[model samples]
Target: MTVNQQILLDNRPTGEAVESNFKLVQSPLPTLEDGQVLVRHHFLSLDPYMRGRMNESKSYAVPQPLGEVMLGGTVGEVVESRHPKYQAGDKVVGMGGWQEYSAVDANVPGALRKVDTTHVPLSYYLGAVGMPGVTAWYGLVKIINPKAGETVVISAATGAVGSAFVALAKARGCRVVGIAGGPEKCSYAVSELGFDACIDYREHTDVKTMAKALKDACPDGIDGYFENVGGYIFDAVLLRTNAFARIALCGMIAGYDGQPMPLANPALILVNRLKLEGFIVSEHMEVWADALTELGTLVATGKLRPRESISQGIASAPAAFLGLLKGKNFGKQLVKLI
Candidate 1:
């Protein structure tokens, strides 16, 4: 019999999660039934949206119940298999939750995808080539809809998703300006990721100044704003959008800390005729394959690069997740169990 450690929801958090919000518990591995595979999780993906799950509120995704294992994406190896579709030693990517091991029915809804790690790291299945990459692709092409020579501004520019947007937009002949929290991230956004310019929001006094810096970097004006931070950055860019600008409203990390929703600048929306829209990645699963194919080509050809801030061990998943919301994570944050 095999036992494994799992992080369970200790209590629903009020605002920012503390370490006490979760607890480590030991549980016996489930018996492998027919058409099931017992997996030893190797990598766990910690994303900003997980923070919303820790609360007892409702959203597009179901809320995490107390005493249940925290929900997340995991990439792992099959230790034993009863299903013909998967065999022992197969690597997979799926919503394996925050458990050291999980028993997944091969026929289960949204069952894991088998991964080929012969050429890439197994963790990339959770980052650049996975959900985040899909998100960037959809937001850029479907939502923002950048035209050639247009200016696109993206927040969190060096992150897995953000860097993907930067590279993809540039490839389409759009000018890209990225906003990150620190000098290191800003430099990486410009020097390595090849952004037209980058603004270190941490050093700037206010969003207006940062927006002005972006304006200077993009003298023509912002045609598209890929918003990750909501409060000030949204307000700043809203004031500078050109006529018929598009806004892809993604994660709102700035307002996730229990802050009241920032006042809407509807007047600007009316004047600029801006199109602001939000999306949940689950809603766009139909296009996942297309996103994967396009991003995979970019990656294989050395056009796209992804950075990850990795923590060791499944136990570190909570801290890594907390760091993501706090802007401590440089890119996609993950925990490697192996």
Candidate 2:
């Protein structure tokens, strides 16, 4: 008999998330059903959006239930299988949550997908070639729809989703600018990621100052914006956007802990005739095949380079998630479970 280790959400967080909110336990594995496959997770992805799931408030997705396994994406191998669709030793990706093993039903839609790890690293399925990659593709190709010689700006530019957007937009001949927390991330964005310029948001104390700096960085004005960090960053981007610009509202990590943060310049949307659209990638399943095909090709061919900040064990996931919310993660944050 095998023992499965799991992390359960103990409590809903009030402000900042603490390790106490999650509880770890071990249990004996249950018998596999007729159409079920058993997976041993090797890697678990820790993304910023999981913060929203911790809350009880209404949002794009349903709030995570308490005392259940904390929700997450996982890449692992099938250890045992009773399902015809999957066999032992097959690599799969699914919503395996924070656990060492998952019993997945093969008949459910969007439950699991087989992956070939020969070309790209197995971990790439959790970040670059998975949800985040598709997120970048959806926002750019479907929303912003940039043309050659246009300027595209993204916040949290060195992160999994943002970095992918940088590579995608650059490939389309659009000049890209990034906004990051410190000088190091800014430097990484410009030097390693091929960004035209990067702004260190820490240098500016207020939105006005940051807007001034953003204007200087985007001299031609921002034609497309991919917003990750809201609040002042949105204000700064709005100040530099052109008349017919498009903005894809991906995330707003700053206010996820507490009350909603109001935009400093909401009127600019109407004044500039901007097309501002908020999207939830999970809700749009139609584009996954096309998005993954392009993203996987770019990563395999050396055109897209995504960085990772990996934690060594499943026990480190809570801290890694907290650090990501604080902007301490340098790139895609993951917890190695194997």
Candidate 3:
């Protein structure tokens, strides 16, 4: 028997989540029964959405129950298998929660997906070539449908989803502008991520200043917008949107800590005749195959190179996740379990 380290949601956050909210415990790995496979998690994904799930209130996802393994996406390898379809040493991606290992029932469809890491890194199956990339695809293709040469803008510009959005939009000949927290992120968004302009939102704190920066970055007015950070960025982007502009509302991370993030100028939506839609990527699973194919090709061809901010060891997960909530992580936030 092997010892497994696990992080469990110990208490629901009253406001902002803290490290104390989670409890770490070590336990013996369960013996694999028939139709079960044991995976040794290589990496655990830390996403903003998990913050919302931490609350006990009603929302899009079920409130993460207390005293359980924190829900998360993971990439790992099969160390032991009692199932016929899988063998030891198989690389796989799954919702294995926050733990060093998981005993998955291989019979459950979509519970574990075997991945080929010859061309693409296995960890990418949790980021660029996985849900984040698919999220960018859905928001850009299905909702914000921008034509070539149109101006597209996104908040959290250098994050996992934004990185994918920039590549897809650039390939389509759209001029992309990004809004990020600091000068470093802004520069990386423009110089590395290939954005037309990247606004450092820290410099423009209020809606007026932010909107002015948007005006300068997008002279043609924003035709499409992928919204992650709401409040100031959302209000600012709305002011700069062209007539018939489409906005894909992804994550309102500004209000994730239970803070109120009311739109300061929602009348602009009507004034500009803009279309806005909020989406949960998991709800749109049908287009994932096509999205992954394109993303993988971009990655394989050396077009879409995404960065990662990985924390070492499972013990770092709680602290790393808190940093991620504060815009501390660049690109995708992950914790290496091995």
TM agreement with the true structure for every prediction = 0.97, 0.98, 0.98
Worst 10 residues of 3 by lDDT: 257-266
Q: How high is the lDDT of residue 7 in model 3?
A: 99
Model 1 misplacement above 4 A: none
Indicate the worst ten consecutive residues by lDDT in candidate 1.
255-264
- Candidate with the greatest lDDT versus the true structure: 3
RMSD of 2: 1.0
Task: Report clash pairs, candidate 3.
Answer: none
Residue-pair clashes per candidate, as listed?
A: 0, 0, 0
User: What residue pairs are clashing in model 2?
Assistant: none
CA error at residue 277 for candidate 2, angstroms: 0.3
Clashes of 3: 0
List model 3 lDDT by residue over 23-114, tens digit each: 99999998999999999999999999999999988899999999999999999999999999999999999999999999999999889999
Q: Any idea what lDDT model 1 has?
A: 0.85
- Report how far residue 171 has shifted in candidate 3, in Å: 1.1
Residue by residue across 1-338, what tens digits does model 2's lDDT show? 38998999999998989999999888888689999999999999999899999999988989989999999999999999998989899999999999899999988988989999999899999998999999999999999999999999999999999889988998899999998989999999998888999999899858999889888888999999998888888987898999999999999998898867888788999999999999999988999999999889898898888899999877888898999999999989999987
